[model samples]
Target: MGHVILVTGGARSGKSSHAEARVAALPGERVYIATARPEDDEMRARIAHHIARRGPGWLTLEEPFDLAGALDRTDGRGPRLVDCLTLWLANLMFADRDWSPEADLLIAALARQNSPVVLVSNEVGMGIVPENALARAFRDAQGWLNQRVAAMANEVEFVVAGLPLRLK
Candidate 1:
């Protein structure tokens, strides 16, 4: 059986950095599945920073909305680091696709894979509910996604101020 590790926290909480460090420690090639889209200059710069941090040795796969497809492509080789599931959820939500099915499929696939997976996500539920409908829906969907991933994950860690707290 494989190991599923979920690293979650709020914005700039170092969840992605923590996930990268954990995956880098593992043996074999590191596959980074980045979900963030470079919709603007700021986002592009953010993506570049993450890429630079991961260095040039890691293989990067940009799957903005097809996480299950990306997981299947991993082929159980090495540790797969999925940087931020929240963006994937947002992409799906924006596309008008209900994200539950995809989330379930991805979790099930992760559970059965032979390679270790380090999934990063945001802990958005700690904040007050959003007044806008879309934002609220996104928050709810993200919460559900986090719960599903956490349930299947062998280890769950929450990062705060660059510190990791294991929850499972």
Candidate 2:
């Protein structure tokens, strides 16, 4: 079985950078599964920044909602990095889709992976709850997803200010 590492942090907490550094140290073909969808100019610019930082060596796959499908497609690759589950969850919520099934699929898939897998997710429960229902739902889902991933992950790291603190 492959090693599963879960990295959690707030926005701009350097989770992606930490995950990339970890993947860079591992052997095999690097696969980066980016879940962010560039729907606006600012988002597009942020995506570009991350892409530029990743350079050309890693194979990039953009799958906003079908994370399990992306993982299945990357079979036999060296290490795989799922850049942010929080965004993936947002995509699902935005599309009015039930996220529980997809979250289960992701967890099961990660459990059976044979190569190194690093999953980056936002730690959304640290802030105050939103007044609206949608935001509250997203926050709850993110917290649940993080808990599930952390439970299955061999290592859990919380990134803060570009530094990683191992939590599990």
Error of 1 at 148 (Å): 1.0
> RMSD for each model, in Å, please?
0.9, 0.9
| TM-score per model over all chains | 0.97, 0.97
For lDDT, the strongest prediction is 2
After superposing candidate 1 on the true structure, give the runs of residues whose Cα lies further than 4 Å from its correct spot.
Answer: none
C-alpha local distance difference test of each model: 0.89, 0.90
Cα lDDT of model 1 by residue, 107-165, tens digit: 77886788888999998887777899999988888988898889878999999999999
lDDT of 2 at 46: 93
In Å, residue 154's CA in model 2 sits off its true spot by 0.6
Looking at candidate 1, what is the lDDT of residue 111? Answer: 69
Worst 10 residues of 2 by lDDT: 67-76
